[model samples]
Target: MKLLFVADPLASFKIAKDTTFAMMREAQQRGHALAVCTPQGLSWQQGLRVQARVQDIALTGQADDWFSAQPERLAALADFDAVLMRKDPPFDSEYFYATHLLEQAEREGARVFNRPRALRDHPEKLAVMEFPQLIGPTLVTRSSADIRAFHAQHQDIILKPLDGMGGMGIFRVKADGLNLGSIIETLNRDGAQSVMVQKFLPEIAQGDKRVLIIGGQAVPYCLARIPQGNEVRGNLAAGGLGVAQPLSARDQEIANAIGPVLQQRGLLLAGVDVIGGCVTEINVTSPTCFQEITQQTGCNVASLFADALEAAVRGA
Candidate 1:
C-alpha cells in the first residue's frame, strides 16, 4: 500500500517522539510504501488531486534512519490506496478547506482516515459535550457574563478555545485569580467565537491520561501527561511529562462508548484525553502519543496500527 501522511515538514520531525514517524516506520517494516506532505503540498491538477515533493520512506532506529524517496512530485492522490490526514490542528479555516479537498478523494474512492466529512464536522470539545455525564461540568459560550458566572460557581474553571489544539489558548481561571477580564477578552472576539469552560478537575494535578483508540477499542498503553509545577494544562507539548499509566475502568468505558462511532465515521485512529476521568478532548485530526506509549511499554503499537491499516486497505 502507498500511504501519504499529510503532516509537517520531514526535516523538522523529531523521529524519537513523532507518532506519524512511528506509523511510517511500521508501514515500511510491513512492506508498505509510505510518503508525506503538508497541506500546502496538496493541490488539484487537471481533475486529478496530487501532492508535491513526496518521497518513499525508510526506517532505522539506528543512526542511519533516513528517508530514501527522492524529492519527486507525487502521483495523483487517488493513485495511493490510503492517505492519513495527520496534520496537527488549531482546526483553522485552512484545515477545513483541506478536509474539503480530501472529501473529493473520498468521492474518487480513495480511503481517507478520520473520514473527511467526520473530521470536518467534529469540533474537539463540542463533539463530546453530547455526553455530559462523561464530561465535566461544561459550557460553551461567547458571552463574558456566562464565563464569569461559571467561574464564580465552580471557583476554578478551565477555559479552552473551541478550535485550538496542542494546548494553545487554554487558560486556568481562579475565583480570585488575576486577569479574568483579559482572559475573557481573548476568548471573545466581538462574540463571534465561543470558548469552552469546564470545572477544573483537581485530578489534573495528577495527570491527563491520553488514551489511544484504534478501530474503536482501547489500546493497552496510555500516556499520562503529568503537569509540571505551577502549570494547569497537562499537555506534553507544554512541558508535561509523559508517564505510562493503567487505564481506569471509566477510561475503558469512555473508549468503548466513543470507539464504535469513531470507527463508523472512518476514524481509524484517535486519541482522547481524560483528566480525572472526564473527557476533555477528542483528538481526531492528528492524535499523537505513539512514541511515548511505545517507549514505556516496549510494545510496537505501530504494528497494531499497521494491522488495522492493512485491514482498512483490504476492505477499501
Candidate 2:
C-alpha cells in the first residue's frame, strides 16, 4: 500500500513516542510505501483535484537521523492507497480549512482515516457531550453567569477552551472560586468563545487514561498519564508520567459504548480520555499513545492500527 501521512514535519517528531512515527515504522516494516506532508502542503485549485506536496520517505531504523526523503512532488490525495491525518491540533482556522480540503479529497476517491467530516464534527472537548451517560457533569457555555452557576453547583470544576489540545488553557476552580472570573475571561474571551466546564474528577490522581479504539474495537491496554507534582493536567505533553496498564472494567465499558458509535461516524481511530471512569474527551484528529501502550504492555498498538488500516483500505 502507498500511504501518505498528512502530519507535522518529520523533523518535529520524537520518534520514540510519536504515534504517527510508530504507525509509519510499522507500515514501513510491512513493506507499505510511505510518504509524508504537512497540512500546509495541501492545495486545491478550481480545476484540479485536492493535492499535497508530498515527499516519499524511507525509515532508516536509526536514532538521530531516522528517515530519508526524496524530493517532494505534488500528488493528488486520491493517488495514495491511504492518507493518514496525523496533525496535532488547537483545531484553529487552518485545521478547520484543511478538513474541508480532505473531505474534498474523499469525494475524489481518497481513503482518509478518521474521515475528514468526522474530524470536523468531533471537536475533542465537545464530542463527549454526545454520551452524557458516559461522562460526568459537564457544561459548555460562553456566558460568565452560566459558568458561575455551574461552579456554584459543582463547587470544584475544570474550565477549558473547546479547541485546546495537550491540556492547554485548562484551569481548576475550587469552592472558593479563586480566579474564577479571570479564568472565564481567559477561556471564553469575554463571550467571544465557548468554554467547557466539568465537575472535577478526583480520580485524576489515579491518572487520566487514554483508551484507544481502532476499527471500532478497544485496545486491551490504556496509557494512564499521571499528573506530576502541582500539576492538574495529566497530559504527557504537560509533563505527566505515562504508565501503560490493562483497562479497568469501567474503561472497557466506556470504550464499548463509544467505540462503535464513533466508528459508524467514520472515525477509524479514536482516543477516548477517561478520568475516574468518566469520558472527558473523544480525540479524533490524532489519537496517540501507541508507543507508550505497546512498550509497557507489549500490545503492539501500531500493529493493531496497521491491521485495521489494511483492512479498511482493502475494504474501501
Candidate 3:
C-alpha cells in the first residue's frame, strides 16, 4: 500500500515520541510504501492533484534525522491507498488550503483519516461548543468587552489562541490581572484571531487529562499531565509531565458522551482535554499523547491506534 503523510517537515521528527512517526513505523512494519509532504507542497496541476517532493522515512536515533524516502512528486490521491493528515497547526490559511486539497483526495477514492470533509466542517475547538454542559467557561471572542464580560463572571481564566495546537499561546489571567491588554494584543497582532478564554481550573495545579477516544471507545487509559512549578497550563508542550492514570467515573462519562460525537463527525481518533472533571477542549487536528502514555503505562498505543485506524479505513 502507498501512503502519504502530509506534515510539517521532512527531517525533524522525534520517532520515539512522535505519534505520526509511531504510526508510520507501524505502517512500515506492515509493509506499506510511504511518502511525506508538507502543507506548502500541495498543488493542483490541471486535473492531477500533486504534492511537493516526498522522501522515504524510517525511525532514526539521531536527532532531526530520518531515513529519507526517495524524493518524488506525489501523484493524485486516488493513486495512493491512504493519506494521513498529520500536520501540526496554528490553523492558518495554508492549513485550510491543505484541507481543501485533501478533500480532493477523498473525492478521488483515497481514504483520509478523520475524513477531509469533516475536517473542513469542524474546527476542533468550536465543534465541541455544541456540548456546553460538559465544558468549562469557554468564551470565544475578538472583542475585549466580551472577554471582560466573561472575566467578570470568572475570577481566573485560561487564555489560549483559538486556532493553535500543542498548548502554544496559552496564558492564565487572574482577576484584575496584569496586562490583559498586552496579552490580547499579542494574540491578535498577527491579525484579528479569535481567542478562547476559559475559566481557570485551580485543579490544574494537580493535573489535566488528555483522553484518546478511538472508534467510539475510550482507550482503557488516558494521560494526566502534571504541571510544572508556577505553571497553570498542563499541556505537554508547556513542560507538563504525563503520568499513566485510570479513568474515574467522571472521566468515563466524559469519554462516553464524546466518543459517539467524534465517530459521527468522522474523527476516528481524537484527543479530549479535561481539567477538574470538566471537559476543557476537544483536539481533532493531529491530536497526540499516545507515545507518552504508552511509555508510562506499557500499553501498545501505537498498535492500538494503527489497528483502529486501518480498520476504520478498510471497513474490516
RMSD, one per candidate, in order: 1.7, 0.8, 2.4
> lDDT-based ranking, best first?
2, 1, 3
lDDT of 2 at 145: 99
lDDT of 1 by residue, 65-101 (tens): 4666566675666778888898888788899989988
Please report the TM-score between candidate 2 and the true structure. 0.98
TM-score of model 1 vs. true structure = 0.95
Task: Arrange candidates by TM-score, descending.
Answer: 2, 1, 3
Most accurate candidate by TM-score: 2
- Would you give me the overall lDDT of model 3? 0.78
Q: How do the residues 188-286 of candidate 2 rate in per-residue lDDT, one tens digit apiece?
A: 887999999999999999999999999999999999999999999999999999999999999999988998998888899999999998999999988
| Predicted model with the maximum lDDT | 2
Tell me the tens digit of each residue's lDDT in model 3 across 1-316. Answer: 7778888785576676788887887788878788888877777777565554566565443555556556565566667777788888776788888888888767667788767777777787787697798987788888887877887889788788777776778888888877787888887663477888899888887688988988878887889998998877778888898886887788899999989978886888888888898888777778888888888888877788778777876882
lDDT of each: 0.83, 0.94, 0.78
Model 2 spans with C-alpha error above 4 angstroms: none
